[model samples]
Target: MTLSFKSLGLSEACVAHLDHLDFKTPTPIQAQAIPHLLSGRDVVGRAQTGTGKTAAFALPMLEQIDVGDRSLQALVLTPTRELALQVYQAIQLFNTDRRLQILTVYGGQSVERQVSRLRKGVQMVVGTPGRVLDLLGRGDLKLDKLNWLVLDEADEMLNMGFIKDVETILNQAPAERQTAFFSATMDPVIRELSAKFLRSPVTVTIDQPKAAPNRINQVAYLIPKGWTKARALQPILELEDPESALIFVRTRRAAAELTRQLQAAGHSVDEYHGDLSQSQRERLLLRFRQRQVRWVVATDIAARGLHVEDLTHVINYDLPDSLESYVHRIGRTGRAGKEGIAISLVHPLDKRKLRDIERHIRQKLEWGTIPTRAEIEARYIDKLKSRVQEALTGERMASFLPIVSQLSEEFEPRMIAAAALQMAYDQTRPSWMRVEPEATDDDRRPSRPSGGGSRTPQTKSRRPKINRVSEPSSPSRS
Candidate 1:
């Protein structure tokens, strides 16, 4: 028999709200943990990301909040601002009662604003460990009356070096309050955290089977002996023309540098990393999701818990250190059973890492040839054809009909149409491609199979600098 949230001890109002939102059944973790949590028992819930664990803890946590008391009765701690925002937003969606108040606090945003909100009597608080500790130390925020505490992503806190800050906040919260711990893995440190804090917690682990990586088409473009990855990327971006993409880099400096280079080439792209302010990060993420920005150059910080709908591509500008991380990065795309593309710009030095990834996945990645100038021009023409068709069907095309008719008298009608198309294509072409340049040797040469490597060592002096429009500014690390 199937179990529902109603059978798991949720009230009618909560069940109706969930049903209205199209949540018909409980996930495995939710089914096991919600009952234990509702009875005031602490929970050590283990589940993978995207397994509905947010709602599993969120529903029960909200159920126990005293809306009438409204003195910051509950606290939710996350490792990053993105996740803090995610949980804050989830609580807002789960709660139907309008009387309850919630606030999210994090770095990069003004601390004064958060202090003001706390002064207004928020019932629930979601925040990052560092900012939460800051506010608590300053006496602007307090957990004296707190009834519940939750540590979401416990393993991530350990990985990010935020465990000490998390412990400080946990030490200050009321000892009598209910506590819960959620993590993807119960590593030794995570287990120790639960052992030290949670009171005889029930363990809930959902078995997540490994997923086959068949849905995503994996391809790698190996940088040639003389060319820089930056120079080689322009033609690839022009050729692929991803609808939306995340280009993963290894460091924040690389992310900013690459973002500047891509922007100079007339691409709608931005940088996302630990460096940017919270408001700036939020704006860029919103723009990327809204399709105003076509791509984002980011570090590994976005590998988990950051979601965008209908993502078309995931590009590895810099390969990750771990094989599992590489798997996780590419898994962001090709979701919902739709075919997605994962492209990697591989240097000759990275062949070993590439091999490791292939061995781990048990499949070979296709070698990608550097797109030639002609191929890109052909793609532009194909895209322009669709635009021409749309323009011909719309009423706006009538204004240019008289000009076409007059030109038809002096020249052949087909020639006149061809001239107009030439003008359109020329005006829309990228500035770098407009000087009638010859295609690179990459187009004529065949790409070697994935294992082939050049024996000659390429020196740094031979490497090309990234073409930048301006100097990059250093943003603070998250």
Candidate 2:
């Protein structure tokens, strides 16, 4: 049976607001945690990042706030600026009546402006530890009357080395305030932190859906020796041809460079990182969600809080620094009970890292060979065939029948059809396939494959065929 917010003890106004936002049924975490939180009890919630945990804590806290008093009654501390902004925006949506003055305080913006807003009065503030502590130290933010404190993504805070700062902030808040701690994993340190801070907290653990592995087909492509990862990725993208994907990179420079390379290769791609302004990030996200951009290369920090439905793929252009990061990156896909694909490109040097990830997830990744030139060509031909079949039955076929008949009078019908297919293939095929450099001896290795321990095969190198058609003279339609 489905549960509603009203049955979960939310006020009529809060329930009505949820309806306005189209939030009819409560998620598992929200359904379980709301009761404890509404009764003014400290709570510890264990769940994954995209499991609707934000609303579970935010809704009850908003309901408990005394909007008439307004002096920073609630404080939510997040690990990254992106998450802080996301939480602030979510709360703003819930505050449909605008009864509370909420503010988001984080770095990368004018301190004077934040201070000006804080002085005017804010009932709630969502911010990062560094900037929040800075404001507290400068007497710009006060929490003497604070009634609720939420430690979001607690494990991420520890991973980012913010535990000390978190503790400092926790010590300054009212000792009797209601505290809620949420983390994806309950490691020893997180447990110790909760014990030291939360007062008789009620623990709530929502197991990750059992269908995660079944929903996402996880695989890895082994990069041949001496070949740059970028080169290996070209064939993989051509073969898989994801509808919409998130390509995870290691740094801002890598994100920018890879996006530039992919764009130059005629793919609809973009770069997303902290270097982009908030407005720029928002625009890129809008484009991605609207399917205007097919792929986005982004650093982990900047990609947090990004939720896109029916995402076709998650490509790890660079392996994450930690196992938790890997989980978070892949979790962006395989959501909404939809099946998706998660692919990783593994270099020879990163064998141990791949093994560590496998052990962490406790699932062996299917080892996939890089698509040969012949295989890519076959896939392209298959795609062309499918398009031709669709166009034959489509309404627009009548418009093109006259042109085909005109050409048929001068050339054989089979020759004309072949020429049309060639033209269409040339326009739609990737540019790299036409001019890929021949593989040298250095690109081959005699050693066993990484992680899977399979012997590498030896084969003679061959050059790719150059099609007769040149690059398209005009922007090709999708």
lDDT by residue for model 1 (1-478), tens:
8899999999999999999988899888999999999999999998766567789889998888888886999999998888888888888999998999999998888999999999989999999999999999999998999988999988788878999899889899989989989887677988888899889999998765542257888888888776667777877787888999998887788788889878878999998887677778889888988999999988887544566778899998888886656766787787756888998888899988888888777777877767666667778999889999999899998898899888888899899889889999998877766765444433343344445343222222121122324423435432
Task: Show how many residue pairs clash in every candidate, following the order shown.
Answer: 0, 0
Whole-model Cα lDDT of every candidate shown, in order: 0.81, 0.83
TM-score of each: 0.85, 0.84
At residue 239, what lDDT does model 2 achieve? Answer: 82
Angstrom error of the Cα, residue 428, model 1: value is 2.8
Candidate 2 local lDDT, 1-478, one digit each (tens): 6799999999998899889878899888999999999999999999877778889999898887888886899999998877888899888888755669988888887889999999989999999999999999999999899999999999989877899999999999999899999998888999999999999999999875341356778888777665567877876787899999999888887887778778877889999987888778878988999999999988887887776778999999888877878888888888767888999988878878988998877778877766656667889999999999999899998998899898988999899999989999888887767676566765433233645533223344343432222211212111
TM-score of 2: 0.84
